[model samples]
Target chain A: MILHSIGWDDILQATLATLAMLGGSLFFTVLLGLPLGILLFLTGRTQLLDQTFAYGLLSVVLNTIRSVPFIILLILLMPVTVLLTGTSLGVRGVIPPLVIGTAPFFARLVETALREVDRGVIEATQAMGGSVSQIVFRALLPEALPGLIASVTVTAVVLVDYTAMSGAIGGGGLGDLAIRYGYQRFKTDVMIVTVVLLILLVQILQAFGNRLVIHFTRK
Target chain B: MNSQPSQPIVSLRGVSKDFLVGGRAATALRDINLDIQRGEIFSIIGSSGAGKSTLVRLINLLERPTAGEIAFKGKPITLVKGEELRTIRRSIGMVFQHFNLLSAKTVAENVAFPLKLSGVRSSSVIAERVSKLLARVGLQDHVAKYPKQLSGGQKQRVGIARALALQPDVLLCDEATSALDPQTTRSVLKLLAEINRDLGITIVLITHEMDVVRQISHRVAVLDHGQIVEHGRVEDVFLHPSHSKTRELVHEAEPENDELNLGSIPRGQIYRLTFVGKRAHTPILGTVAREFGIDYVITGGRVGTIRDVPYAQLTISFTDGNVHGAIARLRASGVSAEHLNGANSEAPLKATAT
Candidate 1:
């Protein structure tokens, strides 16, 4: 437990690292995964942008990445991470791998959520002479907002896991701190702090997501 | 009834629709030739799978036909596309059985949809049109409510308002009130009749209910197996249903005719005496009874009007007599009469027969 009292500066640094990784990875994941998810959904056989080719491609890529473990995904994207961030270690280097590791998984969840939107609503919008883009932006997106929120929550929670795991690849975060101080040095207090932070984040994301979903869906 | 001949507003010739089904083709309509006149309420009715819905949708061009021509007011529009199709569609409004109101939109917004689609910029104009249309449909107060908040009839009223938002020349109803309860259906039907009468918008409706057809339609087309089996003015169709499908669909018994007081008359010798035209007012039964010294057993009948022309049917029986002189006297006076009862069918008056 000495690592717990090992200086407020070190603990603060680890906490900042975790926050940076989590926030940065979340922004990147949403930016990348959202469009990927929309593509997967819209390109599906029955969707607004329906096309067999795009759906098949998205299906293959998502399944391929998902089949490989997150650790392997991070390792596979190591070179791309270095080229983008100009580093292969510490918090600065972690964002690219973290996004690559989480985006496909997040995208798949989003696709499922978008698919849950009613086709009837889409048809009604079309009957009203709404163009393809208008129907997408107004009808499909609005109708599927609640489910999308729930999927975003799930993605955010999964992102927390990805952020934590990113620490192992020579990256600085709560996970890295825990591994460096808590595991390697047997610092029980450090482990407890990291674990507690994760629980709190999960709680906040879950609560917010559930509330947003209810807010949109309730008549 | 106005005797003026209205212009034909919607005309389709040799229009056929076919769908691809698992490497095969299925025909929904085959060379459907029809003309719907202005200011007339037309009804197309048939059993399920008769392609009535498909036929109705053709006017708005929801589904383009695989072959042939559709002309609306002399302009051939079977090949309309993109902006042209939208412009064409704006002049023709359609309602559905499900009352397809956007669940997310308020009644006002739903009514404003067609206007919005037509690129109407002024809210004042849209609001004025919506209010006028809603007032016509008797749904003026329901403008703020969403579809889920309203009953089926109220939802349909909103639908009618929405369809009229563009002030289309033709209104197509695809089984509009088929989803409503009987009472609600009646009220909605009455409202549609009022719309047709007030706005003078030509309406072409599709329904499975003959009562709905009878309620508002000036003329009806009976569809079966993707073909029009019968078509004519509703009164003519009712009076003489020529086609087998028409006979099946025209309905033999009507609720208005149920006021017949059928139980009062003895069943010994019953006859259905029908008088066509002005004779419905004349007391011819009394003349037959007095002229032949015979008591006439009046059974079932009521004062009724058909196609704005009054007509009456009376179920009567020969109360007591050889009934020969009464039959002769009734037939001679331009009053059509018959010997009563199916049970005593073999008996006939010698004077009438010879």
Candidate 2:
């Protein structure tokens, strides 16, 4: 009551801003993550496309980045955030950091997805005289599609959580409003509403992700 | 020097493979040399880990030998690489222990994969080729189904069609029927034999079963510890295995003394009977038993064929024992006989293998 009741316009703008940050970050991540995942999968030990040094180094680097906590990554990537998007303060600034955080995670997920495909299939392709490229496109990618979708769904959920968290640091989303109106002004209602909104977003994301994965898998 | 200038379809010389384990090298093959004539079913048989798979893989360049040379069609393919190597591989089809068909692809796509690799243009052409291959294999209705939806034998038919897609000059099979049951294995092998006969595609296969080797292979090689110990025509090998190591064991105990003991030929004046070529099916055993004027007890007898010519071996004992002249009379019948046991002895005489 102290900071006044929530305005209808604020909720709409906040949701839109959250969507922009999460959607834009996910797009960039998938773009970079898919190829990176393929590289990791193909180059690993015992893989059809084996490369000892390359696979080893990439795996180490991915694990290293993933080990860092998201909050710390956001702070640490401040300069990169500014350089990429011209500001380290708003939703645009938060995107680069969000992508860096999530891309490695998604890439690892995708690598697992690609690896889960039957090795017999790859050999069959080779016995058929398939080149490395053909095997990747026709055999590996198509076979891993369902698992890839599931990974994407999981990644989207993680991004949604990051989006909410980004609001706490002034990225202009529902979280930012809750921080500005609820925590600062001690208004329990603002905090409660933002919490409800996040929970609702999570439910929608999980449901949609499940639907997409099911569609791709035809199950 | 006057031999025909016909090209050998598959040749291996001093081919050896060594794998490092625990900082020591283990040789999988040693100084193996062979020449397989074109359009023949050549089989390599040995106990497991006999380097048969390794040797077959070398033909398609799936594995580079640790030492020595492999040539296909009179060309040394040792240095072939990149696109050239791929093109060479395209002309050779290979099947594996597990059928190795892509579970995700339908039968048509799996069969068409090699053609696509050969850079076949136009889906229509690919489709026509697939239909023709499937029809040949008797799987015309299963073309649209995935490998998981098919039986083991059907999956192998798809594998065969894929291998034959480019109409490759040579086909390699590495235990292709090992994963299948006996009946399915026979049918798949028969299908391979037909492909060899009808299309004249040379086949190189590896197996552990002597029966399989006898069924269709023209030439057979026996490998032990990465070395070719015995190699000859299937008929010769089956009739008289030259090596003590050639005796197949019921189980792996020791390779040194594993005699096949084709059942003990009867003891007590036992005569080792030898029948070759036409003598196999002529009821010679009954005739000899009655005519020899000696009581005969058959302890060992078998009906088999060498070179599609039926034959039998019998170890029979003569009652009242054998007079020296009775042996002379049997020898007069154009039969090779040897005393198995000492005069009325418990063990049959060992005949010298022909």
Candidate 3:
């Protein structure tokens, strides 16, 4: 049987859905993850606010969320996703699960970035009579800017992959379009177009992240 | 400058610091009692792992002592915490060996950091103060450059500028010049002396180089294996080093003094003469030798200043008459004369007139 070619409107719609999921999820990811990451770093061993129990608890919880496969997480959070967005199968519905999956991942990346900052700089800040908040805002965050930008870039690219995988549950995006037309109807043309679009999206996100990292890197 | 120049600005009483290493408590400093006077440069000299850094850190409460009290301007600050501790810290500025400058910030921003931290909100005020500090440290032209773009000496100058932003009462330099070359170290030391003189900021510096202590410090404490073996005026320590560690350090600073080959000297009575202040420039040695009819051959010596006080140490061997009378006249003229026999001796021996 011969397969029909994909339409421009369909490609455009899928592309828009993918961008929406990526943008929405990325915004929330950074907002939630940045502070969480800072908390993790501050409460870590020998850090400014070192609390062994609190650091251990946050670490375990984040690790657990990060270890669960993204597809499994999407299915696991179906009820909460429905409650959060009033549905569980579209651009809006897929956002809650996407954020939950990627925020912890992004937060861990942020913690790593913060840890990479020179401890001497933090000590210098502390010696200068900087309060905890001042040290975090003025010294740690500013010094770790490049690494934080890199983390955002990596998280954005990962979110693109997850948005495509969310298509397994009627989630809209290039992934959903590819699944419905390409997998079910054997339309190789749709599959090829969606795949190419996802790859382009990831490349663009990574390049943008790298540029930001380079722009902020002073060392 | 404060009205009371003789008062101690920073005092440590029986302070000790211990750190846990591999589940065992190891002492970094032990029974460190010190008083840093206002308007003077006090240096703590020690080899690596001798607790000099820890001693300096304790004054600003960067590293809390495991035992004893520290007072800044008469108040015991051992138990200060939270905002009070931070307030006290702001009054005492510290410069690190590595500079510890913020790589992300420009020179002006780095100097402006402490000012902003102390709640200076006005940009114009911060800018004015930052520029003044940079100019003081001789970095006015490079205010826009990052730390990585500057040389090591320039980075240290930035560190000095930042430390002085709050106009601290005491400046703690923890090996501030250890990373710079010889010429740069001299320049930095000169700048520090200038700061101490102009601002009357009591400087407490930790160093392993004896030259640093000899060149700038008015008083010094020699730390050995977590304890202060000796402490006194720099001239006294240089003139008569009682502790073996101090002698070793002083010898390291002046390698020529240690190169005196006693075996190479001809058979004669050797006398080592020490001169300080005006005595160093006096012709007392010549006068005594001529009056006593003694012919002497110069063996070894070094002429230099300690903390800007001229001093000279000479060793001479008398080949002819009245060596004992000449020694008596030398002692009467306020010259420290030590008679040396032959066995590679540095100890002073009593001379008899015959």
Candidate 4:
């Protein structure tokens, strides 16, 4: 009777909202993180476009953002989230904070991925008269594609975890569903189902990410 | 030989490169003066860390010199900026020791990279040029394959094709065959020689192997301790190395020379003879020994062609004989005879008969 009270419709709605939040935040995270990572790589010491001042500034900003705990970041960015999405309590509202929370983290992953590209390949491109932008587009990015895809997968999974945490502040998702009905109301069945679903989601994402990485990797 | 008044395609005048490593400035190249003539395979040979790599990088402006000037086609390269520098770079391509091909790209894409960078907007033209270039390097069937699928030799062929894509007037080979096995090195070097001959593209190659210099190079420059120790026609530099470093390279390339224990042989005048061009195939040595009545023992010898110019060297020992007549007779036949070891061991006589 208690499990029946929490109907399949509620689970379906929560699932859709969770997917929406995941999709939305992942999009913004990659969009912002990819360029930031490229900038970090280009302006890095001994890189093609090494700029000590810009590199220092970016490094500090990324470090500052990454140091803040996700739950605290959710509360801290409440005003900005509300300003951008007109509400700081649902899927739309949480998307901004989720991206902000994870973009810098994802960007560091991107920098690590790009760094794995061989210096010789870059130099060869330079020898061919490839401009900086051409080197990035034609060689650096392509060479790092598999690693970059792996980074995206890791970022997406992390965002999924962050999305569940945002549920503590009425950021609608499976986490909100479990906390509101499963924890507060003592519906162990609902909690078990949501936990199982989250596990399934992560497994699916990891498998997909691995497949994409293998497909792109030639070496 | 120097009668041709053609200007050098690439010239470095008083060039030097210094790097700041851990707060200490280290010199990679020092006041290097070099002239790469048009349509000649000029090789720079040196041991690792002897600034060979830095010297090649300086040609393409990949590593800017701390001082002096580089001229490409008689124009100062340092004065060029941005787009102009790129345009100049397009006309001069480079191949690396590691091949340095894009692992993500197919063979065709790898070869077409330079053309695409040069802003060749026509896909048809790019395809045609890429095909022709790959075919030139003997990789026409490998166009669809990724670099990971190709052999080391094939990868280098792709590298050569890529370097040739822009129809560059000059090609820089940075130890291009150093990573290859001997057989592969021969093939790659052959392809490079063919490219030079057919395309009339000036090739500037850097290698630690003297054989690579002897095999294909028209001229050679030997580097030691960040400086040019020797630079001249390959035949002159390789046959008679003036510097110890050059001698070491020559010895390393031709190891059989050291195996000749001329010191152990008693009572004989040892003469190392060189035969160039048509003389290499002639029976001059037999004729000289028979005419002079000297007992000539063939001690050590090697016969190989250098740059398609047939060449051979032999060490002959004359026992209990006045070898002056034989040496003079060998000289009279237009052969070069260098007297080594035995009675006149104190000073080696370099006598070339007209």
Of the candidates shown, which would achieve the greatest TM-score relative to the real structure?
4
The complex in candidate 4 yields a DockQ of 0.82
Ranking by TM-score: 4, 3, 2, 1
**Alpha carbon lDDT of residue B108, candidate 2?**
92
Clashing residue pairs for model 3: none
lDDT assessment of candidate 2: 0.79
Q: What is the interface RMSD of candidate 3, in Å?
A: 0.8
Residue B129, candidate 2: Cα error in Å is 0.3
A1-219 per-residue lDDT for model 1 (tens digits): 544355568767877887788788888888999888878888887576679997898789878878889888788888888899899888778888878878898888878877776664565555556666666676666667788788878888887787788778888877787787778888778788778877887899899999988877723
In model 2, the runs with Cα more than 4 Å from the true position are A1-4, A186-193, A207-219, B1-5, B249-278, B288-295, B304-311, B318-354
lDDT of each: 0.77, 0.79, 0.89, 0.89
All models, RMSD in angstroms: 5.7, 4.4, 3.4, 2.2
Model 2 agreement with the true structure over B5-102: per-residue lDDT tens digits: 57788888888888787779989889889898988889998889878888887888777888989998889897788787888888888887877776
Identify the candidate with maximal DockQ. Answer: 4
Give the lDDT of residue B17 in candidate 1.
Answer: 92
Candidate 4 C-alpha lDDT tens digits along A10-54: 899988899999999999999999999999999999999999999
RMSD of 1: 5.7
- lDDT, residue B11, model 1: 86
Better of 2 and 3 by TM-score: 3
* Cα lDDT of model 1 by residue, B180-247, tens digit: 99999889888778878888999999998887876678988888898887777776665445677775
What are the per-residue Cα lDDT tens digits for candidate 3 across B22-92? 99999999998888888789999999999988888888887899999999999999999999999999989
Cα error, candidate 1, residue B219 (Å): 1.5
Query: In model 4, which regions exceed 4 Å deviation?
Result: B257-264, B341-354
